[model samples]
Target: MNMKHVFNSNPLRYTAVLGLFAILLAISCTSEKEPLPDECEGSISLQTTIGSEANCGQSTGSFTVVATGGSAPYTYALNGGTAQSSASFDNLAAGSYTLTVTDNSGCTAEISVNIANQDGVNASISGTTASDCDTPNGSISVSATDGAGPYQYKLNDNAFQSGNTFDGLAPGNYTVTVRDANNCEVSLQATIKSDVVFAQVKNIIQTNCAVSGCHNGTTFPDLRVDNNIVAQASRIKARTGAKTMPPSSSGRSLSDDEIAEIACWVNDGASLN
Candidate 1:
């Protein structure tokens, strides 16, 4: 056959085979592109919330760092070089620091933190006052102003409940104290006296019947002006009749006038009036 005749006879088949080969070559080229570099391997990021920076005293703050785009299980370090494993730090000293994180992919990232010292806490007691003695319903309220919370209270150097009212306390002097969370305390003094009639009777009885080892509570018959007044008066009368009221020894005896006063007080219905 002539050359021209042979080429024309199979042109359609040769063209189809060439087209299929070109399509396969295109597919292979598309698959060869290197997988997009794995999203920048071993990336890390950090965050921080700092406490007050001036006069630190119980102030606290925290920071956190995370590794992304890297491998599992990243490591952390603080102050640019200090090594650590935990991703968080708390209540750190006041200062500046740099947080660095490294991922398993060997990628590292850093962040800066400004830590400031906090102002010292201060506390003061307000609205607190010493209470009078012998007051049936006396109270002193304590309040803290411009300071931290959690306050405490005391009375007469004894622990007392907060916002407590001391009632029916006998006539005498008292001290009230208040303390704050920081253990700072303030104190005040108050005096209370019995009412007119009771006060007069108390004074007279204390001067006469309440002599040491005599009619006192520690004596044979424990008698206190605030308690067992009538019983004590009867005892005194019996002792006076026997001329034994003004005990000679111990240098402790009531004068004749004082004795008369006590006896009159007892005879007058033992009335406070």
Candidate 2:
């Protein structure tokens, strides 16, 4: 029989052969995908300042790390030091330091921070003072010549208020002192006073009206006078002598001299001027 005739007669067998060729072609076209690049390394940065150029004992510094292309949660170190986040050191001797950062991917970067010895001592303490006057409420300020952070401050040698500011401080003399990160200190004195005469009223209230067993919070007739001297005087001195203050039995009435002073103060129109 002829070859053409034989092939046509066995069409089912030919179909099976074609199907196997298609399967082989599909397998050959299956290409593998490329892999991704490795993660980026972590990095570190450092900042520093010395307390004084003449003194090496007053240096302060801090360091931070930024991680990239690495796993979450990186670690930091300084001059072989170790920390989980940012790190700070105070009163360090002036010198050089190396900060290193390592990420979860085991990548690392480093930076250098230099601290120079100090040369001059700081003068003055930073601070301001105010009188109970109303003109100028008060002011908050600082005095510093040089050096970085790690600062400490005090008001009249008392604990310093944070945020580098104080408000509503009673009017009077005040001393403020500030020490920078390098332990260099600077101080300043300031005075704030109000023009209003009620400034004196504050003292009067504290001494007389607000005294215990008097017009204090718990006292009877509850004459809790504020900065209003006129109101206070009206309550203490009634036009009718029968209303004389500090009833005879009260045992703590204002002395004659004290009453006379209040009368004069009121007659003066309670002028703070």
lDDT of 1 by residue, 153-225 (tens): 6768677566534555544446555555654444444444333344555575566556664556544444464
Please give the CA lDDT of all the candidate structures: 0.51, 0.49
**lDDT accuracy of residue 244 in candidate 2:** 39
TM-score of each: 0.26, 0.27
Off by over 4 Å in 2: 1-137, 197-273
TM-score of 2: 0.27
Question: Which numbered prediction scores highest in lDDT against the true structure?
Answer: 1
Q: Model 2's lDDT to the true fold?
A: 0.49
